[model samples]
Target: MAGSLVKRQGFGTAPVFLTSICTILGAILFLRFGFAVGNLGLWQTFMIILLGHLVTIPTALAVAEIATNQKVQGGGVYFIISRSFGITIGGAIGIGLYLSQAVSTAFYIIAFAESFSPIFNYLLASDFNILVYNYRVISIPATIVLILLAIYKGADLGIKTLYLVAFVLFFSLLFFFLGTTEYAQNMESIPWDAKILNGKSFFYFFAVCFPAFTGMAAGAGLSGDLKNPSKSIPRGTIWATIAGMIIYMVTALKLAISAPPGDLAADQFIMQDIALWGPAIPIGLAAASLSSAIGSILVAPRTLQAIGADKILPNSFVNDWVSQVRLKSNEPVNASIITSVITLIFVIIGDIDIVAQIITMFFMVTYGAICSISFLEHFTADPAYRPIFRSKWYVSLVGALACIFLMFQISVFYSIMALIIMAIIYQTTSYYKEDKEGLANIFQGVIFQLSRRLKVFLQKADPDSKEDHWRPSVVCISSNTFERFSAFNMLRWISHKYGFGNYIHLIEGYLSRETYKEAKECVNRMVKLSDSTKSRVYMDTIVSPSITSAIAQVIQLPGVSGKDNNMIMFEFSKKKPEGLENIVDNFKLVKSTDFDICVLGSSEKNFGFKQNIDIWITSKDYENASLMILMGFIILGHPEWKNARIRLMVLSPEKELEKQRNKIRELIRTGRLPISLNNVELNEHKDNIEAKSIINEKSKDADLVIIGVRTEAIKHDSIGIFNGYEGVGDVLFVNTNKEKEIK
Candidate 1:
């Protein structure tokens, strides 16, 4: 399933331990630790060690937890991340990780060449005329040899080389600890205290030294070759990390006392000076650097090969070529060529400090991602995510946060650049990737848990409480969904920001094998329609035998936003009112639930440029007046109605027109409605003129007209009360069960 799709060598845990220790003790330990000690002093150096391990140890534990939970495959950490986080995010980080590993190989090779500096200087003094330009002469050649070895002999040769180097690494440390120098013997007169140097700040030193502790993951690179990865990975990585930390603390103490700050700061080979045998220091440095290089070389290609096999790259041919392996050994020859090309370019640059900074940033991102995954797994409480080795959620959170904190602390520019690069990779991968699974899939369980808790909490809260601001929790049911979009558009606007809406399409049949399939298909179509409009409305299909039953079921259903649905809407076409009679028949059945009702009469013009809305209110419409005004304001919140204006038309007797106008002015001013006073007109109403005729004459040009409906009129006239608004673009007849205070 991972890394060129081939069988592995099935090596055991020893290789994991040896590979990691060799890397943990590599060039940084011998070359940079003394520099860190002399510059930051003993106490601060120890603090750096602790801080660095704060990131590594938790990450190591997270790695252990994740490794035990899944069947680990060839790409090592990449395999684990992709499987857990899904392909898009995994591919993004995998690319960054692959580059870090490849560049890391070059980093080790350059350090290996640095070990030959004394020999090169002697040759120059003896006039032997060896080619030299800093360490490039050695590094360039060494890079070529390492690449060739990796390409031809593969991981087998690399693993065997690790054992040999690990042995040499032990003696070198032993000799360094055994040796003592004149600088050390004279240090008894001086007080042991932490000193701050004038140049190269503490965090700078910390950043340089931080990469030393990151070697715990080196063993994980050999995941494809391991005999039993589940058993080996956690033990090897955790033990190696613990051992590395202890050794680093001891070495810092030794370096602090053995040499004066001046010698330790000036001399790159301060450890050699403190060693009993000076040559052993360089030999160990060479062994450690070479072993680290071999480890990186072994892993980098497999990650790239796995990425290719997963089809993360854009080109098909390139994917096929890079993913292909040698038939017998399962060696990723083509992927190694790509990795070698990257390594050679960086090696030719030949600056270890610059390369170290780049590696640090990428590795920081990788560690942070791993810790985030572990924390999320614990939070989601997924039954499938039960790992044999479990890490505390808080520990993983700390690790993730520390990685981010240290990244910016080290270099803010690099941290931002690293994040931007990863984002670009994620976007690119998402474009080419066919799978819909992404962050949503990763967070599905967390969202489920949150939603469940919220629904329960909202249910328990006092629904009768009047302290909360009034917002519609609306649900609309329609069999004429495809025939008219006015109701759906209204629902969308209601839920845009301040409210919630659910649109249910009525599938007129009992729930059964055939009806269920039809309902599913109808729901899918509604989903597509919802997406096309970028609506926030939740949609579904109700497979019930009658419109009344569907209405009953929908009213009983909980709101999508966790609050109880407070409003129900019915829609019918003005030209083809096929469901009007059924809706009129069920008005009382719905009215029994104390839900405010809206009957939308859709027009041929479909809300006519959607610019002007008129609200009609009489003296008897105290409850409906506030509801209509609120609905108008809420509809205006949507971008589609952003340019629309609301006109509140209050009708009264000729003498009471001024009184009604004063009340509306108070209402608008008190409630903070956007309706201008000029837009709030009080029209004189004669008792002889029909209300519908006056409405048709006044609001004929309006895009939408909202008027209040009394329960007595609805019960007396049934569907006839809704028939007189033929002149307006579209009409909304609203009724409320309770008073809605604007404030």
Candidate 2:
């Protein structure tokens, strides 16, 4: 073993202390993905990571002093602030901290979701470009399965799962670092030599390094529930910060030596570049990333539970049993679930980098506040108040200043967003003074307690409002038989996932007039589904309106209640709608009372896993179509859409509109048409050469691309889209249909 003996007893450290170390590791790992900032000069990166240790040390010491001296009554941020400053400030801090941590978990889940992109593409196909695949289909299943697993088994399973994840990450990163190459080359390329940044400019870069220091604070965020927070919290905080700094320094040094800043920032996982380090490093790095993701899954929920326990959140949110060390697994079950749900929404919003940058800004405010307090405490001159392991006040001051300064570095847009978050918290907390406290306390912790109560009350009063899915359609019938309800059930799931609203249908065709009169009895039984489901339904009796123009008729009526957003669900048969399906050359229509004619297709059959559903892209559509092709490509490449393994590309021109994309999907279905609803980007995308290049890259591994003749003549040297201008010969490029085996 080429190991230098570094002492670490797996079980020796206080649980919180160990937690801090792991926490810092997780933060360091955060720097390894999605929208990484430039690696400042070598010396700058080095100083921040190295000096970051000195910075976090003061707050850790201050926490120890307060936790030990203040008589652990509550020992949370609220308690810490009350003892140091006052209760009012503590209350505000409490609320803001809760939100900070809540939003922070979003970063974790987002990272977790993004980290799996490699695995997702690996499972589906190689060269997983953003525009080519759908990660939602891949991640949603994993997230849903995990979420359901967590909710079903309660909190215990989630915790146990996290522990396993930690172990995997530790070993994996170790191996990746060992395998990575060009370390010497990277070291030689340092932008500047060793010159420390002690001036004001430190702040912008400080923001870059702040996450390195926050690891200890992360554990402190969990102080209320720690096994022995006083001793444990101090040890964990101090050591974790040191470890984080070391990681930042080493990783920065390693990265600086290995690649240029431009390359480093772009790679995200610079350590996992297999072309440079051989393939083994990627696996190891992946393992490490997995570990960090799992840790977020475990600890992120606890902070929410802690907020609940303090009586800010609903008591129901604190359903877990954390009083005993053995039952800590049950401590914050409801809060965990809630956090998970909240995180899921952010994940669905896409863009992980934007979410993370916003989080860094949000949390920096809290970190700066904490560090400032520590600086204030450094001068109190009380023996008991002195930190067990205190550093100079200057360190804390720099940390605070750095935090303030770094907050500015995170883009003007994010700065505004961070302020908005702060404003929202202040407004909500002040508007509802449920948790009465003072600002002299811990910053905004008071607001936290009050907000929790209001949130809990709101939840109880209205659970339906929180449900983001569309309501299930009820096809009124006499019985709950599957044959009678299959269409309703299918539409309900599709509507829920795709945001399509419930469609109320009164069966009026095929049978005699007498039979149609009898169908009214069947409506009652069919409508039985709405009672079991929360989805909304429009009650339409099709007796008088003998369905004529299915497409045109459905577009004229006002949408059913709560079933509004861009989606209208209907119960039409596969063999049934000739009136609706035909003449509707550009789309399909059902006889309903709503008119959003641009709306296309029925409910997505495989809404979650949309990969098997082929998309037809032609050169012609690229020039004039309305959609963000790049974003679509990225969404399609999401790791969540694992089931979306097969993507067929049809490169026809004249059929470049919606009709063409749909027809290509028809080609893939082979007969009964196995696919999801047409997922076109409502927004328009340009057909520039650069965009085309990206498309070709996305289409590189495509299963099939059906080509149609181009409207214009093709130059001998140029490639042309078919079925547009005019052409006898057309090129059909099915990726899988290559003469030579694709390697």
lDDT, candidates in the order shown: 0.88, 0.46
Candidate 2 deviant stretches above 4 angstroms: 1-14, 27-41, 48-55, 71-79, 82-87, 119-132, 145-163, 180-213, 259-266, 274-290, 313-330, 378-392, 411-743
Q: lDDT tens digits, residues 443-472, model 1?
A: 998888888989999889997887558889
Candidate 1, position 524, lDDT = 90
The window of 10 residues in a row where model 2 has the poorest summed lDDT is 734-743
Number of the predicted model whose TM-score against the real structure is largest: 1
* Candidate 1 Cα errors over 4 Å, as ranges: 1-7, 120-133, 179-193, 260-262, 423-432, 436-440
Per-residue alpha-carbon lDDT of candidate 2 for residues 447-491, written as tens digits (9 for 90 to 100): 454556565665466533634322322222111233444345434
- Model 2 earns a TM-score of 0.48
